[model samples]
Target: MKIAESHPRRRVAVLSTVIAAIMLYLFIQDVFGAVKKQEETEIITERSAWLADWRWEAGTNDLEVVAGGLTSLQVFAAYFDESDSLLLTDKFREAMPRIKQLAEQNELNDLYLTVVNDIKYPNDTDSQKNTSLVTRLVADWESRSRHIDEIIAALETFGFTGAELDYEKIAEEDWPKFAQFIHELDYRLQKKGKSLRVVLEPRAPIERIKLPKGPAYVMMAYNLYGGHSGPGPKADAAFIRKHATRMKKVPGNSYIALSSGGFDWHSGTGKAVGITEKQASELATRSESTPERDKASGSLHFEYNDSDNVKHTVWYADGTTLSQWIDAAKAKGIQNIAIWRLDELGSESLEQLRIQPGYKIE
Candidate 1:
C-alpha cells in the first residue's frame, strides 16, 4: 500500500521526538540505579556504626567486642548416653562460674549448654573420630525425647538461656532423623520459654534438614584445614565464603564459627597436632623461627626444626587472619561470627580485634 511520503521536516520532527523519549527513559533508569546503590551504602554504614557503638558499650574484651559483644556463649559441658543421662564433666563445672560472670557482666541474652555424644570428656581425642554413638542417639525417639527433657531440665536448673545440640559427625543416612530430633527438641524448648540452637558441621547437608523457625543454625565454618589434615590454614577465606553461601540456605538466622587456635604439623610424618596460639608462639620462639603470613590463605605459618632435627610446619590464625575471616563473612552478608572457644584467643589477637571496626547486620 504505497502512499505519498511525509514531508522531510515532519519526518525529522518524529525522529527527534523518538530519540528524546529514549534518552529520557535512560536518564530515569540511571537515576534510579544510583539511588539504589546509595541506599545500600547508607544501610551498610549505619549497621557498621551500630556495631561499633555496641562494642564500645560492652567493653568486656577485644575478642568479645570483635565477636559482636558476646550476645551468646556456647559451653561444651556434657555428653548424653543412650539412656539420655548426662555425664557431666569436671571442666564444665569449673568453667561455669567464669562463663556466668562473663554473661552477667555483658548482659548476654543467650547461654547455650552444649551437649554432644562423641566426647565423654573435654579434649577427648577420639571425639571427632567416632560417630557411631551419636548415630544411635539420633535414631531412637524415646532416647531423643529423654535427652530433650534432660536438656531442658538442665537449662532450667543452671539458669541457661537455651540448649545447643552439638552432636557432630553423624552419618549421612541419619540426617533425616537428626533433623526430626532437632525439630522435636526445638518445639519442647519453645514451650518452656527457651530456645534450641543446632551446630552444623561445614560439610553437613543443611539443605536436607528442616530446622525450626525459632532455633538458629550455627555452621562451623573453620577446620578447612585442621590437625587431621596436612599442614595448612585452619580456615582459608575461600573456604569460609563457600560455607557461608551454603549457610544461607538454612532457615532463620545462622552464625559462622571460626577457629582462633593453630595446628602444628610434623613434616616428616605428615601428622598434625592442634595447639594453642601460646604454644605455637613458644615453639616458634624456641626454634628461633619467625612466622610468615601466607597471602593466599591469609594465615601465618612458620617452619621450625625440633630437637631430633625433624622439620615441622605450624600454621595458625593471628589477629590479621581473624580479621580477614570476619571480613569474608561480612562480605557474604553474614551477621553473626563466633569463635570456637574464647579461651583459645591470644592476648595480641584480642588487642588487634579491639582496634578493628566492628561488624553488624544490615
Candidate 2:
C-alpha cells in the first residue's frame, strides 16, 4: 500500500512541473513581444518629430492623400465670379471634411482657404480669362471693399482658420491695387482673429506689393519647368538660391514653395503632361529605363517609350532631390518650406525628409 501511494504522488509532482514550464515559456514570450512593440512605437515617434522647425504646407485637390501626414493644408482655389463674389466649389466643400481629418491626425494648426480668380477647373486653366475681371474689381475702391467684407463673412461662415490669397496673373500695372486689396483684407481678417497669407510669384515685384503686418508671404519658387515648358529641372539649385536671397529681403514671415512632382514631356510635340512620382517610376520601369539624377540641378530625369513607341523624357524632383533643396533652403535661412501639391509626395520621398538630420517635429 505504501509503494502504490508513493507512485501516485510522484506522478502528480511531474504533472505540476510540466504546467509550470509551459507558464514560464508564455511569460517570456509575452515580455519579448511587448519590448519589440515598444521599440517600434519609439521609432514612429522619432520619425514624426522630423520637420518640426519648418512649416509644411500642401494644397488640397482631387487627390485624397494630399493632406496625409502634412503640417498645414490650403484648399485649392475658391474662385471669384464675374460679380467679384467669392465662389466655393462643391468639390472644395466635399474635401473639407477629409482635409480636417488629416489635419487632426497630423496635429496641424489650421486649414487655410485659398482665394483665386482663375475661372477654369479640373485643370489649371489660363488665368488670362479672369484678368480683366480682376482689374475691374480692384479699380473701384467701394466695390473692392464690399467684396472683401463679403469674403470675411464667408470665412467666418465656412469655419476656416485663415485665408491664402492666390490671385495669379495680375497685370504688372495692377500691382498696387492688388497690394492695397491685400492690405485691406489683412486688416479686416486680423480684427476677427484670423490670419492672411499671400502667394507671390518668384519674380513678383516684392517692392511694389506691400503686405500688412503679420501676413505670411509665400514665394512660388516652382514651375521653372513644367508641362508647358521644355523638359528640365522644375527648379534648379542656383535659381532657388537666388530667389531665397530675395525672399530674405521681405519684411515679415516668408516661405519658399517647392515642386515635388514631375512632367512627362512628349518628345514629338513638346507637350508635357503632369505625372506623379509613382506614375513616373512605373513608366520608367515599363520602358526599361533607369532614372538619372542631375547633380547640378538636384533633379531626376529619365527617358521612356510609351505604348505608341513614342519616346518621352521625364524630369522631376524626388526624395533625394528635395532633401538637397531643403538643405540649401535651411542654409539660406528659409523658415518655411511648402510643397506645391502634397499628393505628389511618395512614401520614399517622405521617408527621406524624416531621416534628415537637425530637424524635429513638434
Candidate 3:
C-alpha cells in the first residue's frame, strides 16, 4: 500500500517538471525573438552630394557646410563642346581649388566628375541636350572609343576617383549601344584603377535593359513634377517607392537621386520655374500665405501672388520632406542616397544628410 502511494507522488513530480521546462523554453523564446525582430528591422543609410557647375559657388559653400556628413562628392562640371569632346565648365575650373581643399580636409577621396549630355555652342546660343549626338557617338565604335578615351584622359588629368555619365534623353534605339559603351568604359576604367557611375533617366527601361554589372547605377528619382510639368512636388512617396522597386533590376551598387527644391508655376502663362527651398519659404512669407504640407508627399505647397498680381503655385521639399523621402526609400530596401545639386539648402536638410540616418526598415 505504501509503495502504490509513492508511485503516484513520483508520477506527479515528473509531470510538474516537464511543465516547468516548457514554460522556461517559452519564456526564453519570447525574449530572444523580440531581439531578433528588432535587429532585422533596423536600417542604416549613407549620403553623397552633387556640386553643380552652374551653381558652384552656392554648391561649394553648401558642401563645405555639410562636408563632414558626405561620403563622396561629384562635381557636375563636365559637358560636351561643339565637337562633342569633353569640356569642363568655367565655374568648375574656378571651383576646383576650393573643392580639392574641402575634399582633403574632409577626407573625401571618392571624388567624381559628372559629365552631362549637354553641348554648349561657342556663340552662346541655346545649349541643348543633343540626343542625336548621343546616338551617333555611342552607336559608332570609332566615336565611342574616342569619347571614352577623352573621359578617361580627363579623369587621369584631374585625379578624379571616378567618372559619372549623366547622359539624358537617350533615344530608345541607342540604349543597347549606350549600354555597350558603359560596359566598355567600365572595363577600361577598372583597368586604370578608376570607377564609373551611370545615371539613368526616370523613363529608362531598367527592367528590360541589360546594363553592365560593374558600374554603379544611379536612378534619377526626382522630377515627378518639374519645368516640364505643372506645379507639384519634385518627388512623392509613391514616385520614390516605384523607382526604388524598379532599381532592383539594376545590377551592382545603385542610388536614388533626390532633389531639394521646388517649382513656382505662374497661372497666367502656364510657365513654371525652379526655386530653392529658401526662395519658396521667402515667397510664402512675403505673400503672408501659409504653406501647407502635403500629407501624401510630405512636401509643402502654397499659393501666392507675385508683384505683378499674377497667381502662382509653389511646391517644395524642406528638411522634413527630405527625411520623409529617406524613409520612403528605406522602406523599399534602398540605403544609398544621392542629393542632386546641393546648393542653398537649409540647415535642417543639411543635418539630415550629415547624420545619414539610421531608422527602422519598415
Candidate 4:
C-alpha cells in the first residue's frame, strides 16, 4: 500500500517540473522579443528651440519689491509616493473650494493643476509598477492617471478652466515614446476643452534635451542663486535662452504669453552674521531684508520677461543692510516689486503686496 502511494507522488512531482521548465522558456523568449522591439524605435525623439531667463545676478542693481505681480498664482499640490489621491482626500477636497474662492477674488487668468506621476488605472500596464520594492506600490500608472482624470472632471464642477498633465521623470532614451504618450493624453483633454502641460525640472539638462515642446512654462524651481559667482547672468542667460526660445507654446501650438524662472537665495550670509536658519527664514516671512546678519543679498531677474510679464526680485541677506528694500528696488529702476514666495510668507508679506507696488513693466 505504501509503495503504491509513493509511486503516484513521484509522477506528480515530475509533471510539475516539466511545466515549470516550459514557463521559464516562454518568459525568456518574451524578454528577448521585447528588447529587440525596443531597439527598433530608439531614435524618434524631436528637438525644439529654447529661450532663457533667470534672476540670480552677479553684481546687482536696484530691482526690489518683487512680489504681487502675479494675477495668477500656482500652489504646487504635489503628492508623495502612494499619496496621489491625497489631492482628492478630505483636506485637499475641502481646500479646493477655498482655493477656487481665492482665485475668483484675485481674478486669476490661468490655472494649471498638474496630477504628477503615472496613471493609476486598474488596468494600468506593468511598466507603471516600480519593481525595486518588496511590498510594491498600491496604485499602478494607469490607475493613478485615471484618478487624476476623475479629479479633473470633478474640478469642472467648480466652473474653473483646468488642465492636467504628468510631469513624471522619464528616461532620455524613451523620450520619443514619452512624447507620443503625452501627445495622446493631451488629445483626450482637448476633447473636453481642457489642456495638458508637462512640467519639467530645469536642472536636468540631459533629460531636458529629450523633452517635447508644448509646455506653457518651464516651471523653474530648485537652486538658482549663488552658483559660484563666476560666469554671471549674461552667460547663464545665453544657455537659458536656448531652453526657452523654442518652448513658446503648449500642445495646441499657441504662443505662451510669458516665460518665467525664479530668483532665490540661501541664508549663508545670515549664518555669517550668526543668525540661525530658522530665525532668518522666519524674518523673511516679511519682505524685510536680513541686516547683513550673515545673509546673501537677494535680487530678481526680470530682464527676460519683456516688461509687462516680469517683476523685480525681492531679497534678504547679510550683505545687504538696506532697511528700505523697496527704495533700493526703485533705484535700480524696477517698476513692479513682489515678494519671493507666497507660500512661505504670511500676512505681513501680503500687507507689503498691497503697498501700491512700484514703477515699471517697461
Candidate 5:
C-alpha cells in the first residue's frame, strides 16, 4: 500500500511472465488446430499397410471384374439377390460348379451381395423389358428376411469367408425394409456358428440408414454415376476416419474409395464404362438399341499381352485419378481396398491389377 515503490526491473519481470503465459496459450491452440486438421480429412489419416491379409474381387474375370482385381479386395459382389424363389430353392443349380470352384480358391475372402436393397422389393415381370438385371426379392420375409442366411448357406456350403451388401442404387423409401433385412439376417447368421459381417454400402448418410449394431459400416457419400462429385476419396477418407477415430471403432475392415477404370464411355450418355472404341461403336449402330450415358471411341483392344503389359494398363487407366485415390488411401490409414464388380472385367485388363505394391504374377 506504500504505493509500493516498484523497481523498473520488477515491472519488466512481471511483463515477461505475462508474455510467457500468452505464448504458451497460443502454442497450445496451434497444436490443437493442427491435430484437428489432420483428423478432419483423409489426407492426414493413415495410409494402407501390409499388416492385414488382402481380399480381391472374383468369380468372373470380365472387364468389370478385372478393374476391381487390382486391389486386395476379392469377388466384386456375390451376384445374390436373384428371384426370391431361386434364392430360397437354390435354383442356381447350374452355377453350383462355378460357385464351388470359386469357394475352393484359397485366396478368396469376401463375396459382395450387389443388389442389397433389391433383395426385398418388388419389380415388374415384363419379359419384353430387358433393362433391369435386378429381380427384386418377393419372398416370405420371415423365411427370407434372413438374407444373411441365404448368403451364409452358400458361403458355408462353398466355404467362403465374407459377404458385402452393395446396395448401390437404393431409393430412400426402401431403407427401412433394407434395415429390417439386415437386422434379421445378421441374427440368423450368428446362430449357425456363422457370424455376419456387414459392409454398410449405403449411398446416403449413415444416420438415415438403419444398420445392425455390430456390422462394419463403410461410411461413404458415393454417386454410383457421378464419379468425381465431392472432394471425393480425399475428403471421404478423412470424414470416415474422423468418425472412426472419435467413435474409437472402425467400420468396414479397410478404408476403400470406390472407383472404376474399364471403359471410359458409358453405354448411353457420358459415363465411363471401361470399354474400347470397337465395343462402343458396335453398341452404337446395333439394331439392339443403345443405352445413352456415354461411349468410348478408338478404345484400346484388350488382347493378351504379358502380365507386365496388362499390369501396366491396369495401373494406368485412370492414371491421374487413381494417383489421387492411392495417395488418399495411404493418408487415411486405410489398409484394405475393395473394388466392386470384378467379375465384369476382361482378362488382359484384370491381369494388370496389382496384388501388391510391386509385380505380382504367377
Candidate 6:
C-alpha cells in the first residue's frame, strides 16, 4: 500500500511541474506581445514632419531633395498685387510644373498655396508683413470677399489642395476682423470642398484673443533670435515649451513651425542676414572654427571674421539641433511640426527630417 501511494505522489508532482512550465511560457508570451503592440502604436502615431515655404528666391533645389518624403508642401507662391489681388510670381509660374510633378509622384493631398501679407511692387520687390493690408482687407467686407474669391480662383487654376494664410504683423485692433475673415474664408473653402491653414506669429496674443475654429493653426516658434535681436539661438527648449503651452489655447489642429537656418549677426553694425543650415556649416568650416552647441537651445554658434576683419557672430540649427527642438516640442505633447522655408538644408538636417519622429539624432 505504501509503494502504491509513492507512485501516485510522483505522478502528481510531475503533473504540477508541467502545468507551472506552461503557465510561465504563456506569461512571457503575453508580456512580449503587449510590448510589440505598443511599439507598433508608437510608430503609427509618430509620423513624418510637414514641410513648407518653397520660396522663389530660394529655388527648387531643396524641394528636389525632399521630394516624396513630404506629406504636404506649402509653395510660397501668392502675393498681393498693386490692386491687392493675388499675384503669382514668374518663378511660381515656372516652378508649378515641377511642383505639380512632385505632388503627383508623392501623391500629396495637401498642397497649399501660401499667401503672405506681402505687397509685390511692379518691379517685383515685396513689402513684407504689411499690417495696413490686413486691416484694410478684413475691415472692408467687399475687399475681403473679393480677396477670397481671387484666392479660390487661384487655387482652382493651379490645382492647389488648399490656401494658407501666412499674414503676419496683425495689429491688436485687427484681431476681431481677422478672426471673422478666417471664419468666412473657412466657410467658403469648406463649401467648395477645399481646406485652409493659418500661420500665427509668436507675438500674437493667443491667450487674450479669440481664434476661429476649423482651419489648422501654425505657431512660428523661431525668431527667438533674429535680425531684430542680438546674437542668440533662433529658439531654445524653454522658448519652445512656452509656445507649446500657449498654443493649447488655439482651436483645432495646431502645429509648431521650426526654422532650419540661423542668422549671421555682424558686430558693431548690429545687422544680420539669414543663413541656411548648409551655409552656416560651410561658414564654420571655412572659418576653421568649430561650432559650440548651446545646451539650452541645442543650437550651434561660432564667431568668425571676414576679409574686412569685421567680427561676425553666427547662430544656427543643424540636424542635431533640429532633433533636439523636435524633442522639446514632443515633450510638451505637440507632435505636428512645420519647417519654415526649406532652402539649401544640410544633408544631416535633411536626414533628421526624413526619419521617423521620437528617434534622437546622435
TM agreement with the true structure for every prediction: 0.77, 0.76, 0.87, 0.43, 0.47, 0.84
Error of 6 at 48 (Å): 8.0
Model 6, span 123-154: residue lDDT tens: 85879999998888898789889889999999
Estimate, for each residue in 66-126, the C-alpha lDDT of model 3 and write its tens digit: 8887878998888888887888877888889999998899888889999888888888763
Q: What alpha-carbon RMSD in Å does predicted model 4 have with respect to the real structure?
A: 24.4
Clashing residue pairs in candidate 3 are: none
Write down the lDDT that model 5 would get. 0.39
Q: List, residue by residue over 241-319, the lDDT tens digit for candidate 5.
A: 4433332244335345443333332223333334322243343443233233211211222222232332111111232
lDDT of each: 0.70, 0.69, 0.87, 0.36, 0.39, 0.82
Which stretches in model 6 have alpha-carbon errors above 4 Å? 1-59, 356-362
Residue 303 of candidate 2: its Cα lDDT?
A: 88
lDDT by residue (1-362, candidate 1, tens digit) is 13445577678999999999999999999999988876665432101111111122222333344443455666666674334367665656655665566567656657777776644444454344247766666678987787677888889888888888777778888888888888899899888888887788877877766665778878888887876688889888888888888888888877788877688998888989987676787787856657889986788888888899998989988777878987888688675766765444577666544442333224
How large is the C-alpha RMSD of every model relative to the true structure?
7.5, 14.7, 4.6, 24.4, 11.9, 5.8
Q: Compare candidates 2 and 3 on lDDT and give the better one.
A: 3
Best by TM-score: 3
lDDT of 5 at 211: 54
The per-prediction tally of clashing pairs is: 0, 3, 0, 46, 48, 0
- Total residue pair clashes for candidate 6: 0
What residue runs in model 4 are displaced by over 4 Å at the alpha carbon?
A: 1-71, 78-87, 118-148, 157-160, 164-168, 204-215, 225-290, 293-341, 346-362
Task: After superposing candidate 5 on the true structure, give the runs of residues whose Cα lies further than 4 Å from its correct spot.
Answer: 1-83, 86-106, 109-149, 171-177, 195-202, 219-254, 262-323, 343-362
Task: Indicate the TM-score of model 4.
Answer: 0.43
TM-score of 3: 0.87
Error (Å) of candidate 2 at residue 109 is: 2.6
